[model samples]
Target: MSTRKDSLKFTMTSRALKLLGQNLYARPWSAVSELVANGIDAGATTIYVSMTEDPATNTGTLEVLDNGSGMTEEDLEHYVSIGFDKRAVTGTLKSSRAPMGRKGIGKLAALYLSNEYYIHTKTAPKAGKQFDSSWHMQLDFMTDADKEPTLREINATTIPTIHLNEQFNKQDSGTLITIPEIELKGLGTQAFKSLASRLAIHFLKDVLPDLKIYFSHQKINEDPRFKEVEWHPAYGNFLLLSTTKSHTYVQDKIKRKVLIQSASRKDSTTVETSITPTPSFPLNDFENADIANHISTSHNSNTISGAYFPDPLSTQTYPYDLKGWLALHATIKTTLAQDNDSTFTKNQFFSPTQIRLYVRGKLALEDLRPYLNLTEQYANYLEGELQFDLLDEDDLPDIATTSRESFDTEDPRFTTLCILVRDWAQILINERSRIAQREKERLVKITANANNAYAKRLSQSIQKLSESKKRPEEVIQEVHLGLTDNDPLEPDAHTAAKEEYRIFISHSSSNKPIADIIYDMLIELGALPEEIFYSSKDTVSTDKTKQFKMLEKQIRETITDAATKICYITSKGFCSSVYCCFEGGAGWATRAVSDYELITTTYAHKPDWLDAGLQTTSIIDQTGTFTLNRETYMLFTQTINRLVEHLNVGRRIKQEPLINSILEDKIPSDYKLRTRKEKISDYYNPILADMITHAGKSDHSAEV
Candidate 1:
């Protein structure tokens, strides 16, 4: 049962072809990146990516145009030949730019993008000629698996298309590839801008200084405009590590053995000898250097913590150069908006936390975090970009896996690089911790001084108000006027009315679920459960007699005490319930002194019987399952921030859990809340502003 020699050859199936491209580039962004790389390899000085979306169909066409040394018909043939090594066949690329393509299979990214696409190209003229010919071709792959061609048939295929010589002058040489009818979403202005940033992070701009990339996206009728993408490395308290510098890790590992040199006469104690301790670039060296420099320079904030020029790492085994810097971000919460800077928005598409590794100026590994054991404290804040060109050295066997997403860990050079990187990362983490401790101490001193000044103003205001001997209303008004204009601690008073505060959560029994959520949220924001007066909480007394007494006592004390913050969760159940009305009326009376907050869960007009103060406060409607869009998220976070400030919870609040608990679908931010002045005037302004002495106001009569 032996097969014929002709039939013994390997066959290429259609499913295999499709799966090859799909597996190689699982993400659309990766396939697009490969296309850009091909353009760069062609010595293109400028690459333009233009995307046009059709909202009705939820699809788009992508066009990548590069002013590169375009391919000739012969070159086009080589491009179609999968796995053909152009470097081996034609020698080094003609341009000075390093070729970013290697396996020659990068062209498959085109197929991965779409089954049928158009390629418009024109070759550069010969030295003596003014112009060269231009060509156009359209390649269509069989989408149906049954119609696939054999390997020999695929090789025998010829290009079929139209000529576009009239579209350009002979001097213009470039390539434009168009991928039509691809599914796309989130191509709006901001998302497109983020795409530009994402593309910039994929390649090193310094290495390809002459290569300019512009990206743009537009709807069908809109005009296309492109914006250049630039890379801005976020470095904070960073150490610039260089392979050229002398350091211990690059030195050969020492093998030591102890040998007995002498024995004591009385106790027979043996004296041992060993090799001198292995040389190292210890953390102490950096600390000492930094201290000496900081002392001489008078604590300059701009100074770099440290810099080390190590001898080429992995020298004893496989010598390789490492060039790049590692830094600790100011905060580990990547989703936080840094002063409205869009760059820090916790980009799922391209996170800035990982160390990107580039080989021969092309991305070999998107992130090195997975390859290294970086479990040290504050390791999540570690970010860097490293270059290890040796990994892609022409002389070495290809160490990159088939997908080119990462390198072979089994390779000795890769393992050595990992060890060196892990050590350096640990160094960065330790150094960050040291700097953070110093910063924390400084902030503590500053906060203490501020708090002392604030407390002094408060004591003076209280004394003056007591001695005035005016009517209660008149004295309260005067104190409010004085503190509102002059108190530096006013903001803190506003943030948390008291260091120790209590919250009275009033809601109808029917709205218990919403009340429970609010209760847990308040607890999460730093309010102790015991200090929060939620009637339904299990800890509260359930006996009818004790419950009335407790509620009556809470209402009586809260009306007169500034330490109690009242939150009224109003709904249909609340408006109709007699007990809810009692709580609301009690909370209303406290408006003159107590800090009261209102939340409405219905769209209907609030009852006119509600206190005017609660009516003026911003209304937060729970129209759905408390989902947060960008705008709603902002509103919710701002609300939580205010609540925390008023309570003076000692811990910083994290919005992640709250934000993650709800759906984050994009929604219009048209839902507006009242301005701070309008919302706070009725309660926060009159009571809080005058409770402390303001620093700069000579006239207490000024309206806050």
Candidate 2:
């Protein structure tokens, strides 16, 4: 032990072999796609994937047959050799098709999918050779606790011949891989269709347009049916943003015609069921053109090229170029019943809504969201496919992880791509925010108009009721009429005791019903009509300039007067109105010069600005029903008492009677009131309220 040997030998146990076989892939589709990539690397033009399910055993058989340049005897040995790099043998793929597979361990995907599988293969016929031989082999990863098993121990047997399909026999060579006991639970038609769609995405359509994939499914005792899963990219009402403005997708007011293909198999005869040209909207006609325009302007020129220092200490730099289209989806939901396409449909298990990155036509990263670590507002609505083949170029160092799911994020090449994607995502988010703001403003304007109409009706109803000496019995059926506004003693007949303090009613025109209730309650409690500045009656001029002048003069005089009491009626409508905001700002200024007693309609309708520091009496809730409880009634009484003490005025009517009348009779009889049990402790924070009330009093005294 004192002197180590010149070189130490490394060995892998049987348990390590099993671990590599079983835990190589994270998803079922990913493992399956690896097999597909192998076929593509072999220069396959047509591939067929067939799956059979047995519901009883929760297992099935899966077979992948491809008319590709099949493997030779030497190639078979290389496949079983774990961790063998095929790149060392062949620099590039046949026909210059970019090889999607490098690490020869793609065979682990088949091992992970099934306990045992069979592979039958034959190479392309020689120039003069008439009879060609096919090979058949069975393999499994057997783990033993005591002994380690090596891949070299596996054996293969020679067969007379193997036929791929009706078109390809001994003369034409291909490969057929069959997994007899694949442990796949609930494998059916839908699962196969989903796999086909995902494979199309894994191997993009643009890169492999010549490749056609067909899927067939079978149950325990049923005939197998096949469907040609066409490669279709799903996008509806989308705008294409690229590194170049001259791209076809970026053209304005152009309709794109895409071929919609479907295939059905009837007894080995494949029929093209439908082939239609479905037109899609262009940039100018896009529903979300404003957002698309911003994305376009953000990219003045369309090229994304950067140089990165691969070695931090070295002066040499390597240049990389990125090509892809980033598309923003206006709506993920299907707009029409006819628009329901399987590739476009999203389910709990699968969703096409992801930003996929491809390296040499093989999916390197499933989604860029995880790589970028984005939590943007509309991050989910963005989907794209980017290609950065330089990362996989032969001259560059192999940077892809073992699983091939992602690259080394610390790499300068990947980091440069991340920065560009993040910038594009930010542009989409910024535009979405702008569109949201415009929609909010439009909704606010519509609400203001509706509220103004309602306020006018409420004003008319009050005027008509005041014109007649209607008794309580006469107006018992009317839910709007209450004792405060329609008591035996009329408001004009019984004079309110003169008081120095004035009440300012701040509310939106739509909230007049609640505001009128507060106004009548104040009048019944001895606040004179002159001492209250309610814009409804105070600003009665029809001319716009006169009405503005009347509102301005009344608000300035009442709010500046030291001893003015304020009643604010806050609601959604109130917050939307510019006039109400101005009034609220003026009322808030009065707290420094006057000991203002503030009362709000309800806690739910309380504006966010007033939530932190302001102290007010919040009585009713949003539904026009009273928050009837001991805590609320006590808070209301205390606020009114403070106002009465400060103003030195006599109560024309008791506070309890007016509050009870408003709670019991002002709202509709069906609007039942309940005691809110939860958060009742928060309803009455009298210590905090008293502090704020006294703070304003000290400010008033100092001002005087």
Candidate 3:
């Protein structure tokens, strides 16, 4: 075979070059960022970016002026060459700063914002020259298509103009790039803000103290200084995790005997597969002492393991040089706005939850939450920034996408970084969960104690009522009124109860006997009869025509005023009676079943409409008598007690006489009510006897 040497030439159409320039940057902010980055690379102490708009023409001019080492005639020629590798040829800037421009295509970024641009630069004089020389290059994107021009052919037509002395004096050397005829259609006031924010993040870690980027915009008759872009703090008050030493994992030797089986022989073998700790940078020594302690004490082993990032490059090692902070603000305040002396709207930069990644002091990724796979609730409360300079090493493959908005997730470094972030996020989430649970338990304990104390005071008041010489019903009524004055059980409950009655007794007229008994029990337990609205006792009109009206009025008043209702579900005429059904329905419609108690006697059957799981009191036995079982009695008493407690009734008794005594004779004279100390015993004796006699009878008929 014969080999022939041939030379090939690369050519690009003007349209293709224009498209390439347009696609180089996704947003105007990104185009500006490229220029600012170039300024930083040139060791510029101050870079001024200004935009001037002409409203009548609807166009603007964008200018970037940097007081840094400028280009000479040779440099100008190289700058105009497309696809030139500046970093490879020049190594670094004259100031010994690492050059940011690599492919030398950043200059195309200007075409993204404007069609015409001009560059004026002056470099220091050669060895024996008395003054520096200046050069300028003008580029017009609206080139004639008929010319079929190449980048080299176009540069040949516009030779760099040279001057004897430095142009735009006061500085030894500098570059001034002006992009005229800037299309300002999409560039509004917010564009400047977006640009500032993006630039701040781009230089967050690497921006030198002396480097200042002043951004400003000017409109007709407007002050240019009014809306100057200000630097804002991206993250604030976060737990800092700065690295003092870099550590890598290594395999440690450990002696261990293991059983090994071979085709010819079986024997014990020694194997080593353990990790050794490094002395200079301990694998377990977190830069932040607090974080180290937290990880050590954490109960979740998974979280602890996740916080440890192992070296992807090493077979048995963890990478530990990355430095940053992990912060969780259950409540986020805009630190960036405060630092910038500005205000933030809801949908601005720095969301409530964000995991930003920085490389070489520049933000490579804004949000890693999507990659973290953390719970949305917890992720929404997190915000942090991590800097890993190694990711930006020139030798490493470029992981950033063309847009430079984020890194390629397929990259190992990116994947590992996401894993590390997820682990740290998990640790923070677990710690937050622990804190919330502890707070919840503490609050529950406090509430329980308060309820117990409230119940005790109430019980004491009932005991005092039993000691008073006044009738049991009268003392009960007073206590009920006092308790209903204001509910002390819960602050919000108290506010809600203020306009409602304490209790509403819903029962059939045929079941008045049981209702009377329950009424007396409630009174004894410190409930007011007035607060206990029963249609039979509450309605007062006697005339036949007015009787229905009065009953209707009482039902409406009771239903409207009631906070809790007690339904006596008896089988006799309870469910069949329209009035009783209405009352029960009204109560049910107004409040939840939890606010009412269902007391069913022996004759009562559970309704199909009623929930089977509702809190119910079944006191009546098969004999139609209230159950004498100690547990049953306690259950009944406890139900009433709960009602009393919820109503916030007074814990003290007041002895007073009834205004009218016409029904004094109706009260049982043989009711052997004793002093407060013996009231429980005396009250139960007669009640027990009546229940026993009722049980002993063969008759199934009962009035209750």
Candidate 4:
């Protein structure tokens, strides 16, 4: 074999070389990258960040100061230049590094984060130079005449302002990158904790494997207070083997490898993750004769089967080094070990961890957003990441991106890559599922224990409220609710949850204050805000419809599925006007079944005459029988709380599954088809019977 080194000359002048400027990387994390790259380049033992923010613009002001070897005047010139390719990034690292940015283009990504980026340094044996550049319009104006590099000498005056945490002056040498105009999009205090957490996790696994890492003022990686950090592979350190055996078996064997322990809670540990080669598995290889012409490898049915993968999953084996082994990885979120706030950063939400498929030790595919909706999905749970590696670039050319941050699916080797990735994905997803189940069970047990403790605390509060002669001022400030809708306990076997119901709200203009309070009270009591309708001037929008969407909004916002009765708080306001009568009538007519209630201490001397010419309202006295609004709030809160208690959190719940439910088995007899001609007079009894039956079973029969 003969070997020779080849070289190419750059005929283009320094000025002609394209200055990528800011439009280099895609996202905000680029700033994170530039500094980290410098740290890796400097071979620093520690990297500290002082990331500040301005609420007005929701932007960041971050400074990454490290204690790595500094640059000299000669080195500084080339260091600041746009041509790093002319120089070498390879250095004596504290340890080896795969180099996060393979394209040597991440420096341009920094321009995406800040309008102004300043690099100040004080290296060994020479005074430091200060260079500040404006990335704004750089991408769009890279060719503009006015565009010029901004450089200056480091002097005493600029030192104090730019040198944050001035420990660098007396020290040996290091680099400082100041993102003066950090234009963070959708970042805030909420994202700060999140960004730090992500950096900690990524650095822990890929970048800073040999040393301890820190974030903020906290020792995220190695504080004595915190246990040692490690990501233990499930199969310990297993040998990666490959053979001429079926690729499906290769996938199956890969699937059978091991998983990593959960960093979070016990239930959240990864255990069942592995690639499967079995044909019976959903994410395995297959063969399709119709598209046979497309395959170039001239595979028999068995070989095509290796290339064939399921749609969406592409369950097929990914080609690897015809001789080397495949490497796959799974992820787990430390539910128990992690801080509760780990899943978010500056309002940016992420899953606890992700299911990443890899081959030959490179990331191939991952779904960060199962549905691309962390906010829309199980809100309380979101935060995760994935790292994978596939076959050697030679065997899986189409399987890897040039930079390898992404995968190239439609490539020539894509079919095999799809099968491998799909199998790996299933394994990773399975691990995540197991962890999720364990987490849920653990949460349930913890909640049950907490509830027992809560019950005792609630007992004390109940006692105090009962014994107190004068109610606390808090009671007066709180919103009030109306009557309860306790379905009569039937002597016969009862069904599960009841039928569709509404919580009617009746009010007069004079009592808007109380009525508003009542509406809030009902919501706190677990009533669907949609089930309660309120009359508000502001509720209407400019695009007014004849149906008066305002009324719909008012009702929908206040009502919920569990509501089934109306609480009528009447007063002198009621007997005096049409406003009061209309309010009551609206509540009555708006529901599938309307139950009215009145709150007061005094009964009308002549009740019917006092409410003459108006719709009928069931009135109750506040003197007894749960007359107090607060009492109703408590009652309803308790009832709804029970329903909530029964319905498990983070798990889907259906009305039909509720034990001993209402509408489930006993639909009200009245729901039977009533003929338009059957007559209003003949309908009352049968309709009522059906109503009673349905009231005892099933879902609300409608959305609130």
Candidate 5:
């Protein structure tokens, strides 16, 4: 047998190492988070993330120091190794904090922030030892790039120096990572401020109670925006929606699934496992048990299991342990209105109207307005946060994007959450609409009460006018037929009054003779000329002369205005005139046909297009004469008077009542009128008889 030393070694390409440095972290803040996570994994109770920048040179250095169970020389070797699993060997630290660093790639995160980084660590001393073993190692990407670096080459090349000096006693147990040359030059005071906020939100629960995080020697709580992160209750403002009597929803013990892997002699397989119902216990107990079993099992025959249980306090069923409150702005309108001058206008991300989502106390997503698909009106009235711990469960597949900026929409869990959000948003929208309707009804009732009181006051004024020897018509005008300025009927009464007109007359210029007669009649009946819009009289030309185009425009406006009545004078000329037809059509289009009437004379012939149901009055008989001679004039005057009354004009003239009495006397009590066709037949019968007598005489003379 050949005596040869053969040892297993892991190696990686130089390109792979370079890629790791470049792609391990997306943003400088994410790199910082990785460092913080590492400290948390190390059971750090307090972590300091400090930055020193020289604006003159645009250079900066970042250092993260954690007071935790740090690393030994052997631990330092494992830390530098790529793809090494930290939890597999050490498990959770003594502080019982869950390990945040799993893949051991968090160390490479520092490389993304700088080309060079150094680590100094001192492990906790064993029993009977006065001092701990301190170790320091430096990683230079610049030097590593120059060689064909391998995992073994890189790890073996660096030998951490053991510090035996008194300086080692300064820190009991902790680790410090220093990046002397930050590659990202954009990180300045503002950037660090933003980073501090991000840290406070991401480690919202982790950094509280025992763990304290600081930036540039200032605690996160010192920042005004993040001050709440320190004192913020575990459910901060979440339960306030209920006490405030706002619209809210809370669901817990939602069903969720996680993928489990099992290995058999033939092949390994994966299966979806749901939480099994069990007695209430700490969630960490399940996670720790699963992780411990996973680590100890053989690679070829490993198995994993999951547990599920309903929260006894949960009131609603959901897909995950979701608990939150959605508050409507209407419920807290008074409070929000007070801050309207300051807070309402600003489009900040953390506005109260926004929805925040947290996974295990870490804000996984903020401002979920886009996903909620709420209208601007409804969205502004909503605000709340929901906490779902299943999203942060270690064994569950990562649904969050690489940058952790948002959750992956493609993830089933995230998609389900979005669906729930959409449902809640719809519910809130309907509720808000219902509340608004109630408010509208309340205002209407108040207005109605005021209107009744106003009407009573107006009635007293009208009675006074009647008692003052005013004419009946004058007293009617004082009565005010509809709502007035102080009527308290509608809020827009003045605007509605402005659009009102008395009459819109649709007549042809060829029929102007008759139309003018009617116009004069209306004026005689106490109708104002301004109120009666006969296009020929009302419209003025742009050229200071009456033009048809200008007349058409004026006619359109007059017809569109709110009018008491639209009268169409139907004559032979009226039926043939295109402008007359257009005016009539416009009247019907602008207002209902019931508001208009048709007046026919002997010269008028009903058009085929005219509806038979139209109320029409004939002023002349088929002989082109007044129907009952002088009685026709009285009937026409009364018809015009009735129209004037409908126009709400305040006066009526006493128009010769004796003439109406005489016309009624002339009509025989037992007489019945013949139809138009029968009368025409009777008139032609005598003439036809005479023609027949003359024809017979002429024929006899011809025969002789």
Candidate 6:
């Protein structure tokens, strides 16, 4: 639409257009993720992102180009058109069960990253003769807001064939997406490298040996970089089920079996089973009082200890000695169509991740396996990708999000998939345990039993476990849960973690006041003190060298031998003392040995001495555990009643209307740690903020 004045004319608002251009990409990360996805979708082995800044102007540019199947002119027009609404009204759309386009909206995500971008591309030999050798398209919406975007054929003859400043390269027939608009701050090479590394750890994996991913200018060969996750000798060889190439992942309920899609589609003798065993280890361990605590109380109110693996060791490959499950490493899906929308970021996983349950080279759970998405239960660790055959000929909507990093959870297949996975979760924990046990026995025989007697015993104990219907083994998946700082601002989060958690606390004597307070608070909430792992001054002897070893020995004996959840407390003493840091060091060292979670929190505004409880509370919250507080605890315990119900009833934690009632009010945040008045702070202060901002519950509670 255009309007013209007889004597007056309006210049095209280039500035408005520029703003639109700059804001085109919703998030910078999304833009980069999109480029990476394109490569994966095109079968690129190595994806490199080169980030550099020109110090003189301080204006920076990030270049992310890939060696995937380059698009032709036709693909550019049909798939990259602006404001395309091919799938907005039509719920998730999947056809042939293998396509990955959100009709076409995923491309505009690039516009949101920066105002200006240059797209360079090349085509494969199959359809090459029609297009230019290498064409460039530059668009900057932020600088010129009102003008229609201009696209023209560009000559790349004079440009650098090789990007020297970026020191990057491209494959013979690939695409290059250069983002020339870094408005806020120019990222350093290190930041880009780190992101690239994290992505590789996630999307690019060891499980699918055929699939390959590269970061930086360097290639990622199998080495220290992509090591398997080690659960230590204590956890036994957590082997990666290299179920051979014959294993086919099937999700009959998710889509439908398309006999025509497979050259071999015969039904097998694969048996379906249930996962009914409660994991060998209890969450809070209320069942047994004889166990010792490895970590200590937080010494603060509001939050409990978190799960953290010690450093160095925490990051090491799976300690099983036997090759860990690569399939579990960064959840991999061999079928590209089965992946989330390729139009969005290429290598991102969607939430409510589900795992595929396979048995005897066949999928036991037709669709879902590992993740339990009762959405009712508020399961967040439920993230993963199921790799199976395309025997099911079903139409699936694009599995990618707007940015294309993950799947479109709203799709109907998602729920159907969940039902399928739930069945597998039921089966694996029950019948499969027998099979896993058999495999373990065979593996044990292969080891010749010299020094791993303890591992053998642990596996034996696991095999002998009594069956509980929850089927804990089904919870296993290859998803990495990363939580940044809690938005001290988010409304009360779901504390459903209550049913499925094993916590470990670590602290020092200087903060005992706060630690004890935090410990009591957690205990009231159902956490056993022994699981708290209390440590004091005498625990660390004057012998400095022995400090690390001593701490390791005690903790290893407790956490490794006992816990599933781990948390670390940071007080002034812990932060100031080299011994304490070394104790922290020991925690990091043993992550390869024991899967202990390490989370640190300290008081934000309180004084160093008086705020001991505050500091302890801060660290617990930092670990990112969903929290509950004193008032809620009493009400919760009262509602459920009988410690026996909470401890052994085996029923899932039933959330009530009162649970939502906790939303408006802080559970009395004014009290100090450990005191009867203070125990109300087990929350990450979320409910507190909620009361203040929305209902003033904290202040009104004092009046009541």
Task: Find the candidate with the highest lDDT and give its number.
Answer: 2
Candidate 3 residue-wise lDDT, 1-704, digit = tens = 88876977767555655676788776677788788776676667777777777788888777787777877656666776786766666443555555555567777787677655666566655675523343333334466532333332232124221221123456667776667777778567776566666665566543355667777677755645523345433223222122112211101111122111111111111121122121122324442222332121223322222222233343442233354555554333343323322332224433435667766555566777888778645566666656665455565566666556677776555555555566666666666566456545644553454445445544666686655565655544433333243433434654212223356677777666556555656665456676677666645666756865666786666554433455555555667777767676665554334345666654255555565556665556665665344444444455555556544422211112212111111222234333223333233435433433343343325534
Better of 3 and 6 by TM-score: 3
What TM-scores do the predictions have?
0.54, 0.54, 0.50, 0.42, 0.43, 0.36
True lDDT of residue 38, candidate 1 = 85
Is 3 or 4 the stronger prediction by TM-score?
Answer: 3
Pick by TM-score: 1 or 5, better one: 1
Instruction: Report residue 571 deviation for candidate 1 (angstroms).
Output: 40
TM-score between candidate 1 and the true structure: 0.54
RMSD of each: 19.9, 24.0, 22.0, 19.4, 27.3, 27.3
Q: Against the unseen true structure, what C-alpha lDDT does each candidate score? A: 0.55, 0.56, 0.52, 0.40, 0.50, 0.37
**Candidate 2 vs. true structure, TM-score:** 0.54
- For residue 139, model 4's alpha carbon misses the true position, in angstroms, by 12
Please write out the lDDT profile of model 4 over residues 1-704, one tens digit for every residue. Answer: 87775986544222222235334434454347456656655656666666555556655566666766655555555555553432234342223444333334445445556544556565555356443221122222344434454445544334322324465555566776666556666665556555555445444343354444344422222222222223322222111222223333333433332334433222232244333222222321324422333322333432223332123344444433221122223322343222222321222353333433333222233333332223322222322223323333322333434333455544434444444334433443444456557756755554454334334433444455654443543221111111112222324533222223344455545544445544554454344444345563234445546335555544543332233345565655555646556545444443322124444312451235222332332223343221223233333333333333322221122122222211112222333535333433242233223332332232221111
Q: Which candidate order results from sorting by lDDT in descending order?
A: 2, 1, 3, 5, 4, 6
CA lDDT of 460 in candidate 4? 47
Q: Which digits, one per residue and each the tens of the lDDT, describe model 6 over residues 472-585?
A: 232111000101111212367421111212244565555454344444444544544544455652455667668667766766554333212344546545676665665555
Q: Which tens-of-lDDT digit does each residue in 495-606 have in candidate 1?
A: 3122224567888776565466556665754466655778777647667678777878866654443245567777667788777888877765543322356666543535
Tell me how far the alpha carbon of residue 355 in candidate 5 is from the true structure, in angstroms, after superposition.
Answer: 4.3
- As for lDDT, the candidate ahead, 4 or 5, is 5
Residue 129's lDDT in candidate 6: 66
